[model samples]
Target: MLEVTGLHVAYGGIQAVRSITFHVNEGETVALIGANGAGKTTTLKAISRVVNAVGGDVHFCGEKIIGVAPHEIIRKGIALVPEGRGVFPRLSVLENLRMGAFVRDDKAGIAADIDRMYAYFPRLKERADQLAGTLSGGEQQMLAIGRALMSRPKMLLLDEPSMGLAPIMVQKIFEVIRNVAAAGMTILLIEQNAKLALESSQRAYVMESGEITLNGESAALLHDPKVKAAYLGE
Candidate 1:
């Protein structure tokens, strides 16, 4: 449901992404796996219009989104759960979730989605009145994902969702990701944890030095010798 072609992103004179191309079909979980400085995050930011693309085309549901404003992009059914779990620290968990539906006007639908979020994340429900900054790392990550889902997006862009959590928390997070994909959520994931990304996604792309180096089925890439050596540390 999303397509990015010949994407080139830069900041001033420094180019962060170069001629990158990829796509995520309807109901598919696609992963962009790479090390630090590999432009994985930049590609997602470019697609979401969080950063401008110097050259390229980003189309979502057949509509061009490269020039669209970030808020407009969210309204168009794409929501990004950025790297580092950017939560509103001072706001209560409930308040932060309510903010996710800020672009909508349907009170009943928004309230229903909030209930769904609470169901999806019971910990969030328990801490509804607690300040977001006071939650644990795993709890905060859950809050972030729950908040994004409140927007009722057709496609979700998750950047390093497994970052900074304990191993058990990571597993729990991936289980939620698997359930989301199973329920037909179109997801484009940027993950430094190649193993988790490949395990959770149907298809995967490897990026290096700001360009796509390999793209294929996640299982095949999982066993590929080169991918194993470079990213999986096999």
Candidate 2:
């Protein structure tokens, strides 16, 4: 449902992504795996229009989206749960979730989605009135994903959803990711934890120095010698 071709991004002469191409089909979970400076996040930001691409094109569901505004992109059924979980610190959990539906006017649907989110994340329901900043890392990540889901997006962009959480939390987060995809939401995931990412996604891409170096089925990539040695610590 999403296509990116020859995508390039630069930070005033420092090119972060150079001619990378990839696609995520409908209802698929595609993982972008790479090291810290491999420009994985840059690629996502470019797709989300948070950063401008200097070259190439990005299309979502057959329409060009390279120059569109970020909010416009979100309204077109794409939402990004950024690397830092970018939640509103002072807002209550319920309030944070309501922000996700800011672009929508369906009060009934929004309320129903909120209930669904609470069901999907029971911990969030328990802390529904608590300040987002006070939640634990795992809970905050849950809130972040929950908030994004409140927008009723067709595709979700997740950047390091497991980043700072304990192992159990990481597992739980991946489980939620898997469930989300199973429920028919397309996902383009950027993850540093190769093992978890590969396990959760159907297909995976290995990125380096702002380009795609490898692409294959997740299981195949997981067993590949180079991918295992470089990213999986095998």
Candidate 3:
């Protein structure tokens, strides 16, 4: 459903992603795993148009979307749940979700989606009127993913969803991601927790210094010698 080919991005003279290529098929979960500053986040930002690619192509469902505005990209059925959860601190849980659907005009559908999100994350329902900043870190992450789902996206770009959470909470977050993918949403996940990310995804890619260094089925990569030693604590 999404294709990135020969993609490149730079921060002034510092090139972060260099001619990277990958794709996420419909209803499939793919992961990008790397250490700090490996360009995993930059790749997602480029796909979401938060950062412009210096060269290469981004196509979603056969349409070129490289230069599209971030909002437009969201409208085209792609939503990004960035690292740090990026929620509006002062906004109520319900209000933050409403912001997610700002690009849509279907009031009834939006209402239904809000209800669905509440069902998906019961905690959000309990804190429906609470300020987002007051929620616990795990709750805030759930809110971020739930807010992205409010847009009813066909594909989700998740960046570091497991960062800073307790182990149990990280497990819960991955469970939600699995359920979301099972419900037919394509996902391109960038995660620092390589072991969890690989275990959770169907296929995975490893990146280093802005380039794809490895790509394979998740299970295979999980047992790969280098992967085991470097990421799996082998």
- Top model by TM-score, which number? 2
Q: TM-score for each prediction?
A: 0.97, 0.98, 0.98
Give a tens-digit lDDT track for model 1, residues 1-234. 999999999989888899998999999999999989999999989998989999989999999989998889989999899998889999999999999998888999999988888887888899999999999999889889988888889999999999999999998888888888898999999999999999999999999989999999999999999999998899
Give the TM-score (vs. native) of candidate 2: 0.98
lDDT of 3 at 86: 94
Residue 54's lDDT within candidate 1 is 93
Instruction: Write candidate 3's Cα lDDT for 56-172 as tens digits.
Output: 999999999998987799999999999999999999999999999988899999999999888888889999999999999999999999999988899999999999999999988
Selected candidate, larger lDDT, 1 vs 2 = 2
Q: Stretches of candidate 2 above 4 Å error?
A: none
Clashing pairs in 1: none
Candidate 2, residues 85-119, lDDT tens digits: the string is 99999999999999999989999999999999988
lDDT of candidates 1 onward, in order:
0.92, 0.94, 0.94
How big is the RMSD of model 1? 0.9
Full-model lDDT, candidate 2: 0.94
- Per candidate, the number of residue pairs that clash is 0, 0, 0
